[model samples]
Target chain A: MSYKQVIYTTAPDPAIDPSLTTGTFRLNTVPKPTNVPADKLLVRTHYLSLDPAMRQWLTAKRSYIAPVEIGAVMRGQSIAQIITVGSDLSSTFQPGDWVVAYSGWQEYAVLGAKEVEKVVLPPGGRPTDAMSVLGMTGLTAYFGMTEVGYPKEGDTVVVSGAAGATGMVAGQIAKIKGAKRVVGLAGSREKCDFLVRELGFDAAINYKDADWRKQLKEATPEYIDVFFDNTGGEILDACLARAARDARFVICGAISQYNAAKPQGPASFMTVISQRVTMKGFIVFDYAKKYPTALQELASWLSQGKLKRKEHIVPGGIEGAPQALVDLYKGVNTGKMMVEVAPVSEALNAKL
Target chain B: MSYKQVIYTTAPDPAIDPSLTTGTFRLNTVPKPTNVPADKLLVRTHYLSLDPAMRQWLTAKRSYIAPVEIGAVMRGQSIAQIITVGSDLSSTFQPGDWVVAYSGWQEYAVLGAKEVEKVVLPPGGRPTDAMSVLGMTGLTAYFGMTEVGYPKEGDTVVVSGAAGATGMVAGQIAKIKGAKRVVGLAGSREKCDFLVRELGFDAAINYKDADWRKQLKEATPEYIDVFFDNTGGEILDACLARAARDARFVICGAISQYNAAKPQGPASFMTVISQRVTMKGFIVFDYAKKYPTALQELASWLSQGKLKRKEHIVPGGIEGAPQALVDLYKGVNTGKMMVEVAPVSEALNAKL
Candidate 1:
């Protein structure tokens, strides 16, 4: 049997220079492994999650984790299915069970027990919700608000890239958690309106607005309490200047400055002191253990019509992974971006 | 008897373009206050403490507190004495009982109990320690370090403006708290030695050095657990980048950036998220109630030879107020800078 995977031609270099994003993704074919053991199964990929955090893997440097080596498979979370089992084992991962796995952007990935956490889809929702509203991105918003952002009722909470996967959920979650005025800042007017109308945000500001900072100041006269920052750089610095006393700044990503050769610093940092604010960062991987609780709660909200789940699906195959991610970075994808691999097969199932 | 009180006038609208350091200081005469109550005492100013924070009062805009109104007396702490008693309650007042007052840049003033807090000097030594070690500046360092910085034994700590009043005592407190390495960032070469050698800091880095950032990285390779920052621009930014996970950055005073019409903004904040650091601003006025405990601890340390005190005294009446404060702004004075308004009656008595 043959498995198609998104293989790496060159790892991200240390400089974070232009070469890192020099279309570093590629597709390759690899031979299937031997027969799976009784406790293992093969998973045929249905979806591959693309995120900005993956950029960190491309660089070889002293970071929170080891960098992805050159010519290795790119790591990611995906929704996949068990096609074939080598032997009858625990019922948790029986064939046809739709599950979430760290299966990378690959077609036929092999896995052992506990390698994937099965996604229990709601009555009417698709499996993609597991990767968006109920997966790592969902947990990122959940914990980022609870532990870092410290959301409070009637508080002015601003979120950057408000239409992106994480930002949308983060804004909605802030509103759900009783933020009185949830301000969404996105690149396009459509995304801004979508944030305000579709997600129950109190207001939406376009980052492209020439007077966005002045508008933000007028909108939040008392200053912002929590800033769920995804797109860092100038806007993040603007929010810092407008932060109220004891404000909480949650840094989930800095996409606006991430791809640059030299990341731009904050434009006004004395506010961090003058305003008595707190800024902290966390990784969703750090909160992996809490996924079960997050998934259950999110699924409950989704089924009860309290939350909206969105997914941007890309056709699965070895060739589409690179452009799929590129489209994601371009802000083309609305929700959790995924790629469908092959029809459920015995070869893929045996490794699940 | 008639007396003329002196006041330093603001050079009518003193607005520094923020890109430059040049400023003007002026002196003017004030009419003596004609009202005096039974409980209110007439304070003949002695030594007027000139703190770097005075720069804020010269401006006409809003800051942490309202900037000193033009034509209004400046706001500050002054060591003074009772000149005349209005009531027959001789038991309540002597011709000269030394006290601390917030009478601003004036030679004669009337203050109620709320304006004055009595000083109980040490039995064996000069009472100057009250202004430098047990005063607001000393207490500022004390509570700012223990409460905000929270240094633990064996933890490395870096204090910016390390030879200034607050930083000087802040580093000493870190040492007393059992910090393994107390690193200091001071302005001059002599201050660097004064910090590490005389104050027993494990390391000292002169921020004036061209390779200061490199020296900071080398001196604190293990990362600093606590950063007691009095200077908050580039040095603070550099330390923020090199901060270890869970490091605490306490913003006691951003002296380096305070006088700027608009601070040049913090330049290296990405590390705040990457390192999960915490930074907070504080004012000594907020911790006024806890001064007794802080003063008690610091006074005991001074008595036990565990801490040293320093003061830069400028002699003259209220006419010297503007120049004294201007000298402080130029970093001309070391330790606590004060203008000797009049001889403390007790000091003269002791000399007699």
Candidate 2:
């Protein structure tokens, strides 16, 4: 018997093909492993996350992480269920244990025990939260906002890509942390409405609207004190123009300009000097030592229903992973976007 | 008797006229003051400081400060001598006392006693040092380099506009603060040579050279850890590209883009995220409470001959103020550029 796995077929120049059908990736069937290594475990992937950062991993350029090489398994994080425990780790690990790992776009993975993080779900957290709210996505939002943005109580916080996974979480975190007025920039009216109506954002601007720039000006009458930028383009320029004195810009992701051969910087960047603003960029991994403290607070907010999460989970397993990633860049998904690679077995006694 | 004063005659849009012949300003003949108000002192301008920030005052645009209004004496800082003291200020200010005041581009000014800061020359400091190293130019470099850049002992520092008053001081401060290497970006070969041989920079790159970017790359082989940027353009982009992890960018001034209607942002600004860089902008006035501490240290360095200052004095008095300002934007001045309005009165008891 064989198992399916997606392989990166080409390293795109400047930008990856947003439409994955251009032969940039190939779904290959590989023979199933007959045995697990003594220090490893055999696991079956349940859900594979689709993220904007995946675009950077497709190019042979220097970034936070190395690019996924051609003919290699596409890099991704996934929630998996342990199918077998290695002989050397039978006492510590058991079959049916749920763990989150870099299982990539594959049905099955053979991984060392240290390569996988055992998932002990907090209260109100579902299994999917391991790949969404309680995982890297939540951690990115947490550190990027609290540590870098440093939003004061009276700060008017503006979040771009507000309907997406990390962005929605960042905006919600801002509101929970006592931001005065939370404004969101989304790509569509539905997302904007969802941000305001469902997520408790004070206002939402659909960047697609013709009068979007005007709307931004009106929304930020006091000027933006804290800006958590996920998309960097004209929206970044507009935000820079209205930046309050000593505004803090948390540079998280530039989803809008990721595909451009020559990305344009914000035209109003000089405002950084005029307004005495500070722009800082950071990676979530930098705060790994403090993750427990952050997660404890995030879990409390989630358990109290103060923090809510929205997910756009794509079904049809690994085959849909490519298009799901493509759609991620297109802003087609609201909140966390992931592909359901497989279903958990009834025998797995996990509570979540 | 009449006095000559330069008045802003017209406001230019997009970009200011680098040529004073464009009639943006006019030399006006005004009557000499007959009397000083009770709270004012009649002053004779001696030395007028010309700065790149003057360009911002030429346009009717919002900035850190209000623009110079049409028909007003063009705003400037000058060292002046008290010629006559008002009755109310007679006890506090004596004739021939030297002071630094915003006396503008005029041969004489009637200023409030509070408007002028009495110039008490420090040991081994000359009268010109009041407007150069010990004045706003030096203060800007002090806080901007120390507080904003935070150059570490092993850090590789880079300074753009490194030949200018503020930039040269910032680079030296970085060296004094124990930076491992200091690289300077200058416009001309002469300026570049002066930065290395005269000011003791580790290396200097002439940005006007065709292979300047390559030179910058070679000079900062360890990568730029602290970048004090005074000129914002391709130079900023190059520094961003060569930025080391967790680099600090002190955005002091953008003389290169000051004249542009649409100032371009750094194209490689994404490196801010990739390398976790921090870019902060500031005004020297914000640190007014700490000015005494900064000035004391600067004066100490000056007295020990550790800190050096170079001034390009245009000898043709107030009549040349307009063209001197135009030449300033062209980067013709190597260090602190000032116009000598009049000879300091020998009656002044101020120490040299």
Candidate achieving the largest DockQ: 2
Candidate 2 per-residue lDDT, tens place, B120-200, comes to 777877777889899999999999999999999999999999999999999999999999999999989999999999999
For each predicted model, how many residue pairs clash, with residues at least 3 apart or on different chains? 16, 0
- Whole-model Cα lDDT of every candidate shown, in order: 0.75, 0.88
True contacts kept of each: 0.50, 0.81
Candidate 2, position B238, lDDT: 89
* Candidate 2 regions with alpha-carbon error over 4 angstroms: A18-22, A345-351, B18-21, B345-352
DockQ of each: 0.50, 0.81
RMSD of each: 3.9, 1.7
Pairs that collide, model 2: none
C-alpha lDDT of candidate 2 relative to the true structure: 0.88
Please, what is the TM-score per model? 0.89, 0.97
